[model samples]
Target chain A: MTKKERPDNRKLDEIRPMKMKAGVIKRADGSAQVEFGLTKVVAAVYGPRQIHPRHQEDATKSVLRCRYNMLPFSVSDRKRQGYDRRSTELAKVITEALEPALFLEEFPKTAIDVDMEIVQADAGTRAAAINAASLAIADAGIPMRDLVTSVAAGRANKELLLDMTKEEEDAEDAVDVPMAMMPRTGKITLLQMDGIVTPQDTEKIICLAEVGCKKIYEAQKKALLEKYGS
Target chain B: MDKEKTIESKTLSAEPAKIVVPGDILKESMDILPGTGTFRENKNIISKVLGIARTDGRVISVTPLSGVYIPQRRDYIIGEISGINFSNWSVDISGPYEANLPISEVNGYIERDADLSRYYAVGDIIFAKVNDISKTKYITLSMKDPKARKLTGGFITELTPSKVPRLIGKAGSMITLIKERTNSFISVGQNGRVWIKGEDDNVALQAIEMIEKYSHTQGLTDKISDMLDKALGKPKEKE
Candidate 1:
């Protein structure tokens, strides 16, 4: 089957222009605004303090809670507020990705909450949220093992694009691979690859994700330093 | 001070150093490793090196070779109440879920029989401690703690919650600038509420307005710092 062509004839491993701003929220302990092309996300961090209900306490580590949401107007189609099943799943994935990178043991009996809102969703909203969340934590001054940089690599037609846009993602015969990693340690925090791929293809996608993540990491550091100098 | 001097010297270096590999120490004293670059194979796996650290030795720290978020404790945050329960308020802490602030943790002391509604109505802005959390996802808050309470008597300016860190700057520099300029006691809450108490309400209001206007722009810290300095008739220091 002939595959639909993508705009901007570029290499499969290329990413869109990325921009990040840290400490975008004046009141948040930590906050960041990140844009991967037109996909924009705002993330904020709060806590490392008490857990409510006096029940969810862990004697050895802090509970990492994350909320991932898309605003009503973020997409071309308006989304409703509150917990949608997709957001719930995204939240869990985000929390899992962040858990390994955070020094949760440092704040025992406490919880660190991360909230991410998609202001604009062009594509790769989940990955963008992961990137934004990491910056927000740093801006909030939360102790972490490392930053969790995430990127989505997908097979469009036979080509693996480093970061996929909504159009590219929705195209037929597309396989999505969203992965997050501790950029410093080169460890995988969250890895989700849907669709069919040979082991070779999977390895190639992971490598593509790593490249995208590194570019993202540079933007993140630049944003952080702009807000919190060296 | 020495570290700062070294960084300045490196920035001014005439020779553009060749790309350094991961684990290569950039400086002897700091032992900081240069960041890694990216590589791709078979149009599939594209890998990039993030950074390296000496975990086995005395120097034990992890720095990002790539980019990602890191959360620290005792970092002040500003948030908003997204959901409310009978005994707790769920706040959007800026990730995926809400953080809870319980009635027991309300900032001010309430008589045992007094209605919590009277003090902390839903949407009312307040600051409290992130006291604890449970395995079942219960977040505990404490307003009675000295550091937690309702922010009052100041002008509140709102911004996208993500922009809060820039407003605070590194090491409270931005906030300190606002405080010095307006001569106001300013308390920033994680909930997007700012409390500014100035000798003159006008001055506090002006400062808050300025912050709101330029919160998202570049060079805001420097701009606000300069504006504040001028407003206070303080001479700007040569950086």
Candidate 2:
């Protein structure tokens, strides 16, 4: 198939435009807004503060809580209010992805709450949210081994696309993979796949996702330096 | 270069302080020790957050520009009573860690297991100092010092604890200016809470905001002084 046959009419390795800004929310200890093409997500980091439900507090490490939500108007069809099974699972994955990068032991008995709200979703919202959340956590001054950045890669028109968009995601026989990493250490933190693809394609997609995450990493660093004034 | 020469050249000298992000390599030397806001890995001291790198002798640490206040030794802080235990009272120090004020560290000795509620109840604010912090980050408070006591009848506001130094200024100049100009008794906690009392409470609060906004800028003391004069409607004296 020709390049014109690809969804979004772009090259196989071309990613969507990404923009990130840190310290956007006044009330939050740290906050950031991120945009990957048409997908928009805002993440706020609250606390290392008191953990409620008093029983849940951990004396050895800070409990990191992450909430991922999509605004009702975010999708083509309005998303329902409250969380569904998908969002609940996504939240757990995001929290797990961020936990490894933090020095949780330094903040024992505290909870760092990360709230990521997707105000618009085209596709790859989770990846965008991960980038935004990493920025927020850093902005909040929580110690971390490194920032976790992510991107979605998938097969479309028999080619692996760097950052999958809505149209490419809905294509027939698509194999979507969302991958996150601590860019500096090159450590994989989160990886999820949907649909079946050949071993070669899977390897190729993961490699593409790494390259994509590096780009997002630069954007995250740029945003942070801008807010903190270099 | 020999190891000693390299160490001698780097020791007691630091690059001008600049903001750094997570994973940024601060220094690569076994001779230099890593301090707060940094972690050591394979002779490389890497920053763990976005903050300013502060070097003292052979030790390099990072001070966060913004974030929760982590209690350190001998830091004067203000806390609110959250709960009372058998021998200790839990105080919220506005950070992730909760501080415990043991009865022994209170102003005077109180009988153990006696009705402690009468002494200090929940929601009562107190001024104290961090006595000890456990490995698990359990904070302990003490009020045996003369300045440490139960604070009352004042309003509290907060700033980013990192900016507290700016508010206090060099040798307490900024705070002294605020107190004298506003005629308000001000107590600043290292945890970022500020208590102000007097008829000029509004003026103090405004001056504080100005300090916070211009903390990083140069000539802030003069700027705050002009602001206070204008707010107080004082005419400029003819030079």
Candidate 3:
């Protein structure tokens, strides 16, 4: 279960190749698709619009609802295609990660629904979802304070790594540390770890995540600017 | 990966209209006022939306290219009679919230409990003004203005609400040009509803499409004018 080197031959601090595009879905108010190497996710934003069950409306600001789903075929084992405990947890975390970046007060008594569909899973789907969700939110033209970007750093075989794949995630002593942040302020909105790593290594891993997230942030910005033809 | 680039804070103010995304610093001067779609943070005017930044004297604003229409007082809008109540009519103003059109706001008076549908029935188009938007985002529409009335026998199409100003152009020049060329009565709503009342509005519709398509580009007026000329069976005007 131990891997001595990266399966893709990537540097310890290198992230997988990323592809980000905004305004990919026509029906949704805003949509984007992101690919972190083979893992692809499409995120759609559908509000700052009316929220039914008027009782659910927030008086002071807009409410953000996130749904993270993996299609049945997205994984080799075939996901359940239904909301399970794992997807629910991921969706909640993703929502918290993105909420800080938005100016939800701009659209009062409304709901901003973000739906991220994982089309392929090579691990690190949560981070990829956060990256795509922010892009989709920007594309929807909802006002925001900043954009949230995310990535995972982990330790496998005593070596810290950026953007681990399923291979690295399956290794013995693997430590998956996925983080989401508003890069401008360097504020971490999401941080989670699954395996053991030293406090010193955790700090280094976060620094690695910061670098990875910043790169994704730039890509997210470029995609938004391109949509507006800038 | 490319090296992180720091935005030089010393860029000249009022260089030109440029597109910006959220958190982008539109200006870094105290004298510069942050207008709508922008916020001032720690002496820097940062953009709050993803759109084009425009300058008006010392005030800088960002115009969003897309999003739901937010109703404001005095904004001319088009709505539909979706439901009727004893006191007011619920109108769909193509926004996040349905608008209220009080019975008193309508023309003429009718006896209580009378058939309201006899006057302005459901599915009717109303060109009205937003009287007020409550703090809770409840939109109240008024039809008392002389310009406000029930529009009949017209084609309705939607445009990007933010581009309504552009479709109007500087002081109604763009809309005026299209009206004259197509020989149609065009009424544009701030909510992005466009009504065309005329014999042939195909050319006008195409012109609108062209405007929305090239809205972000420069020299748009010229391009629209050229499109109109060719569509109207006239020679393309010399540059």
Candidate 4:
């Protein structure tokens, strides 16, 4: 079918350039920074210790609190920190995404909080945050079921693109699909989509995202090894 | 209706396909589009539909079919106070639940009927220990315990709970590195609250920021210590 294409002229399945670095933050228990083209996010991990208020303690398992935040300058518009509805929602989504991967039961009555800060936004801020947060957790030395890799794929101009850029996302009528997966067990932890696509098209996008997530997962592992050695 | 007819024609012409599993390597050769679904390895049609569930098409997200919950001890965390009682306080610990801290958990003593307000007022940020939990779901906390106490005087940095291990490093090596270098007393709460105190606020602040920067690194202890030595102009050896 004839359709207007993306500026990069990439094929339906091609992903953008991906770069990842771990140990970017010193004070956090674990940290990582990832960039998908222009999209950038930093993730840090803290916790698995004590629950301060005696009442909130869990007798059975540890808790995971996740916060997904975008810097004021991360987007075209400036954003504030703390308790905004968007950040709160993002935090809950991230917490749910990471819950399965973490060994919460290992630290009963405690909680772990993962914070993701988006330094720049092109497209796929949430996906980038998920990928970076997984790396940060590993960097923090938290045991996990596996590393989570995420990517955004979309049907732009009827063509599916892996890792959509800001321009492509803004210019096209596309369905954005973000997914997180465990590199080792090949399990899915989080998946999200927006806009519209035929069931057949959606299936294709998921397949492509999984493939992209694996590639991103490899990059995450490589970065971790490089920073930590072996 | 012409557009509908055209789309129907395209669907018929579209190649018969399958679903992609979690670990499947997606490549151009793969018939699935980047944002589309895939066939399972068993040839079952697996759609990586978006949002919370299959019915929510506008939203795209993947969720576990099912799973179990388990808790571990000694994990770091960040918690918020939800309620305060005469004997204890309640917190939302971000699990399937909330946590509690008894009055005895306060670092200092409270006269039998002393006002609780002087101690841990509502919304106070304290770092305590999770002593134990009853099967009935009672979570016990203690601040008098050496490991649990009031976290005071330090820059508070937040991170993902997953990365806490990397910050502490192998057997607490990472934190030790920062403490020795800056001569700052550091306490890492299980709930993601970190407390650092030192005579020199600048030194303490710098050390905390560095920790935030490198928490995820392996072998970061040495790298950071060396950086601190140079930045602070302190002798490599401790006095």
Candidate 5:
């Protein structure tokens, strides 16, 4: 008989242990550090300052730029030192996810930059980076319609899961769906899939991800409010 | 000190002032209007930044706790010359955009090729007015106002731009008290730079730092005045 217990003994709908703190970087306009189980990530936001490379300047609104990098020692197998294809792709998607929440038109001809650095990796580094990025920008005081919350959900051993660990992700039939949304409006801003799943499984996985994101959204707001003292 | 304001509107009774983050619903009413750092969506007014949310009767506004200085028209501020070109000089007022001061904005006429740096070299400070801000971030500053002039000798200190209003107090009450006690000629810029030209400005600087640090707390004005009195060695008056 296939085992019914989860890898970490967490409920099927439960995520990892999450902790978030905003304004951790002294020099950044805004910064945040978030941990999901053993995965730790820090994000720093700068600007609405001047945008370099005059050609990149948009006359009507501020440009939003994002960079996502994983530390060489984050994974058991040391990551390659520079921007490979995967980091570049994640950065593009992460920027698109955050852009819709911000009112970039307010600061024309400028650029708001978000740097996400992953110090440790478990299973859902991309989602953690997105959460950290959203908090950092809000901490930087950039006006935004809402904070975006993200999480990964998947199916392993024919059972759906809210957040999968590396062990579960390695399951032979596992399918991962990383998603993000604006918790206030329930509007999905990011959705990506790896491995095949039934259409019904896709819908169920998304619903599971939403539940995870809602809890994370509350954590993001609490982190920001705590910065103001009580 | 609350990072707030109540202009002509009266106080709102429904929700007391509280810290809020982006997307927090401040009010839910069709009659309520969103103002500065707030927006209206589907009969709900939402906050757009991390700040203290306040309601002045039918309007809700949020005063953001921190942000880069965005120049406004007619705001007199202290700026340092960062770059000079043939036609105009670029001034950094600690904002994302640079303000260009054309030679015509100043009082005298000068030859075009007469070396622009002679009049205002890089690193000189001036108290000028923001004359215009274009949609494309082109800023124009004018020094033609009688109150505007070059500020020499005084050193510049920085404060968070959002805290500038608190440092100035209600109709100059807080700043004036500090100036009188320190015997300093203090010029506070809306852009967050304070210029102190006095024999002893240590007391003034300390008081400004306190305001920056403790701007969120209640009853800060009286507390600062007491600190200033103590620093100036003035006898305490108890009534």
Candidate 6:
């Protein structure tokens, strides 16, 4: 059977090239950089330290604060320098995706702050950002129940792809499904759909994403262990 | 059949010391008890985060090799005074939570609002004990003991809190060697803060950097001693 070829010469089920590195920043308690195809993100973890504005402190669990930003020069056009609507929404979802994996109760009344800056952006920037942030948190030595891994799967031209790029994402009738998972338990932590997709396609997309996330999880684990010389 | 084989081929490498990430199932057995860095669910023992799987007497755990310091009870720590309120001083013990040294927790009776800044003004470094940690994450500190006092005339630096135990070494052997060779007084806090003083301060600091840099390397003790000897120019005396 002849496999349908994507513009990038990848198979329909193939994801783009990816890389993840931990402990990239000396000053941050923990930091990681991740690259998925053309998208690149650097995430730094700071604090378990004191939570300011005393009232915001949670007595039962550590608060997770995430800030997702894009550099002005990251894309074709110069992006704005501060938080925009898209960035805010991305930050909220990213935080929610990571919150469940942490053992926040271990560090009550403190906050684990994650700052993710996208230096490059394709269509799946959010997935790359979450991937980088999880590595940064682990690098920070924060206790977590598991590392969260993410990937974007989509359907284009009546075909399902494991990971979609900016071009594939912009195509009309394209369906993008970004999903994050805890690989060991195979639990989905984050799922969002853009564009219309059939229920069967959604199921296929989710399964493909889970498989892709498992691969990403291996990269994350390798980067973390490399930092410790293990 | 091909897809089924592919899924089966994705099984984790079970070799001991192999790195495991969160959600990776370490085992599936009720005989093994989950320990730190691990959790059990659905009859499977899985790692909660990044670490190496370790088993001792049917108890399984993952020992994290990196990350920040999470404060615990009875940990001796060094902290810098950040703020002073009516009754307690906020201390930065290098963790997520700031420790509070209540005036009452000090060795001497502090007069209420009687120029208490003289006792522990903002920016003073204190060697204290984790007296108690409330559920709200309020860390209460105590300086009533002899070693617990205001530290003065020392250079302070930091390391990953997880590496602090390695720096201290078995039975404090690493610290003892550093002290004897450098002839400097040093105090290591559980929060990853270290204070160094005396004539061999430079030598001591070099040794510490070596330890922090090669923390995961083997023969750390010998490496540290060699680094110290080179820095201090002290010939090794035969034991």
Rate residue B162 of model 2 by lDDT: 77
What lDDT tens digits, residue by residue, belong to model 1 across residues A1-230?
11334575545677788888877886666788899888999998876555775588777787988999889999887777778999999999899898876667655666788999999999788899998998887666555556778999988867777788877887787899998997755899989988988899899889889988888877776776565333
C-alpha positional error of residue A108 in candidate 6 after TM-score superposition, expressed in Å: 1.6
- Sorted by lDDT, highest first, which candidate order results? 5, 3, 2, 6, 1, 4
- Between prediction 1 and prediction 6, the one with superior DockQ is 6
Provide the overall lDDT of each model, using Cα atoms, as 2-decimal numbers.
Answer: 0.64, 0.85, 0.86, 0.63, 0.88, 0.83
lDDT of 5 by residue, A138-207 (tens): 9988999999999999998889998898889999999999999999999999999999998998999999
Superposed Cα deviation of residue A171, candidate 4 (Å): 3.8
List candidate 2 segments past 4 Å from native.
A1-9, B1-16, B84-88, B108-121, B233-239
List, for all models, the DockQ compared with the true complex. Answer: 0.06, 0.77, 0.79, 0.05, 0.83, 0.57
How much does each candidate deviate from the true structure in C-alpha RMSD?
A: 10.8, 5.1, 5.8, 16.4, 3.0, 7.2
State candidate 4's DockQ. 0.05
- Among the numbered candidates, top DockQ falls to 5
The parts of candidate 3 lying over 4 Å away from their true place are A1-5, B1-15, B235-239
lDDT, candidate 4, B21-108, per-residue tens: 2333333233333332222333222322110111122221122111111223444344556787878888655443457878766766
What TM-score does model 2 achieve against the real structure? 0.88
All candidates: TM-score of chain A: 0.93, 0.96, 0.96, 0.92, 0.97, 0.97
- Model 2, span A60-126: residue lDDT tens: 8899999999999999898888999999999999998899999998878888999999999999999
Q: Considering the true interface contacts (CA pairs under 8 Å between chains A and B), give the fraction that model 6 also has.
A: 0.76
TM-score of each: 0.55, 0.88, 0.94, 0.53, 0.93, 0.90
Q: Candidate 3 chain A — worst ten consecutive residues by lDDT sum? A: A1-10
Candidate 4 residue-wise lDDT, A85-180, digit = tens: 878887888788877876666566677778899899988889889888887776665545566787888777667778888787775587888887
